[model samples]
Target: MQKTNKIRVGTAAVLAVVLGVSSLIGFSSSANAAPVTINFWSRGAQADFIASVGAEFNKINPNIQVKVTTIPDAEFVQKLSTASQSGSAPDITSVDLILVPYFAKNGVFEDLTSYTNGLSFKSKLSPAHMALGLYNKKQYALPFTAEASVLFWNKDLFKKAGLDPNKGPKTFAEIEAAAKAITALGGDYKGFYFSGACGGCNIFTFAPLMWASGGDILTAAGQPTFTDKNVAKALSFYNRLWSKGYVAKSAKTDNGASFAAPFAAGKTGMVGAGAFFVGSLKANPEINYGVTPLPGATGGKGSFAGGDNIAILKGTKNPVEAKIFLDWALNAGQKFIATKAILPIRSDIAASDYVPQDPRYKVMADAMAYGKTPYSVAYTPLIADGQSPWVKMLQSAIFDGKIAAAQAAAQKQALAIVKKQG
Candidate 1:
């Protein structure tokens, strides 16, 4: 095979493919052999799933071994940035879709377009999934899983609220009325649950409500749009929920877990969650729950796209073998799909018997169409920083009944962020 660059990148930027391999002794070999050991890294609770996938890959090609490293998600960006700066990054890495633009722009990864040339990309993935790898027209990352936010409701709780378990509300007004009904009959019950503490999940899960209402945090060119009327309107909607006591006040610091607990414990009627939530629910055999698409805002559907991305790191000694690894990893038959908790990225693979037999599996596959992820270079990591102010804005307006000032403050803070990013 011809020598070329085979590094992978994250979402939104174009990746360039060039032919060349490093002369590093540990990674380059005449063949896939014991001499070659590829280093890789990832963060988040999903590390177990990734490790399982890597293990499956090794079973098929024992010669090229992959050494996996995991760091807590809270420290992921810090560790990855430090490693990248010091030239100690692994041969492969799991990059967040939002972080891809920043990492690729900073020259932290190699372009992966060439390596993906002979593989079946289109038939395997959805258009949105394919778009995650395009950074400025270059291909850097390959989509490994399809994730989306959905409305998960406790069937038992819904029935208690005098609503049909199978037929949830279809519009925002209906949702509001339902929430009021649920709250009116409250005894350790909440109509809606969302995180005022976790900006990463909140931005995706809640921002879509605004997007569906026809507003966005930023434009494609990376300018502020938080002042848009639709944004104010959406914020007002959530604010009403908070004022009506339909929301859990504990959301102030809980991020993802707090919202999950109330719903999981059967105390709350509805919570917005991702495909992974299906697995979480399955683990609890006692909770009888049903999921539906998030309600449309003014007659349109929207939600955040959530998933991990796979990429080859720069400075690797074997481009060819890495390509083989990526192609094989994307195969529909990999054991990782069933055994691991992550859902498959390929639509064709998602439809296969290996994944389709389970009833809850269908919702995981359906979420891709409803999910939308941010494309900003630095916006991703900022979500985790306490100073981001997204949660406080929601609380100020919704919980405190200060809609006008809250909207203005949120817009100011959001614009400041965009300007700082510039």
Candidate 2:
């Protein structure tokens, strides 16, 4: 119920950083310099990948040097904010899709739409992913990855539950029923498990349930739509699952452990996760699992679109060079497809090698076409706050024995926040 403090970056320092980059870019090295040292920054988690991309790019454009550095993942945004205010920001940076809205809103990015005009690559990206890096109809960034929520069930668990391992749940009702059966097996494992603390995953996995059932937290115009009966019905489904003890208690405090730990340990019957999950599964062949689509409402399927975005800083003096690099990233051939990402927001490459061919990966790519992404400005914090109420409400209603009060209280609070956002 307490308001979470806003951890926004101070504006002054960031503004200064932007100016510094601009001045540096203006300095003349040689017209065809061998290394045009450009500062590149990435958060801890993505630093390695960015470094690899830099290495590959350097091989082709040896004259253009990209110096990539890692910012602590937890503090990456704040650091960027600080750099921008301080007027010492990097020439280029990769941002989480969720943060794009905030950066775009602040006018901290170079508008690449005009530079990219005449390019029809935008049509190649899925609508869900295409929306992540867009703000006010301008393209500030290009997508670096595409991910969505997918159902992952332990084939062994399904067999034990008298369900077909090859045929996973297609509808929410079926998933609920299967979960109940898995719980009846009764042991260290549960029928299903997911993060109660994870806002992004909650939206990806659960919001679809709300939307598929004909409800949504916010409408296309960004109005609160949670008070609608459909929304309440979706919430009720979650409540019923928790109340029935199909969810593990550990899920309450767990944001990461729920899916990875349980699935890796072979304790959970089912989970909804991204395609990257396959990499983790590969590490542990001992754990047998199968990937399936996220369950639909009655029969319809949908999932949230997710990915990273790249943008040039607002004050960059080398918009031409930066735009060249952006274009190269989305250009045809191996460079575009080599990153294991979806499309480069370019259709030509979207259907090319970038689209995975494996059965599991194909499912992910196919789902992208139908996915929908939430537009949450300052998304990292908004998601945390938004999902917390629903999680707490479900906990009390299902586990703590206060169904009616919990429902009324949660609905009352969530609706208020939604209204405020509207």
Highest lDDT among the candidates is held by which one?
1
lDDT of 1 by residue, 345-406 (tens): 77766666435656666765676765677677657533556566566566676667676676
lDDT of 2 by residue, 216-303 (tens): 6666654444446666666666667777899887776665445456777787888888766665687788777877777556867766
Off by over 4 Å in 2: 1-34, 44-48, 71-74, 332-350, 354-356, 385-422
Per-candidate clashes come to 20, 16
Query: Residue 186 of candidate 1: its Cα lDDT?
Result: 63
> All candidates' lDDT scores?
0.70, 0.67
TM-scores, one per candidate? 0.86, 0.81
Residue 115 C-alpha lDDT in model 2? 60
Q: Candidate 2, TM-score vs. the true structure?
A: 0.81
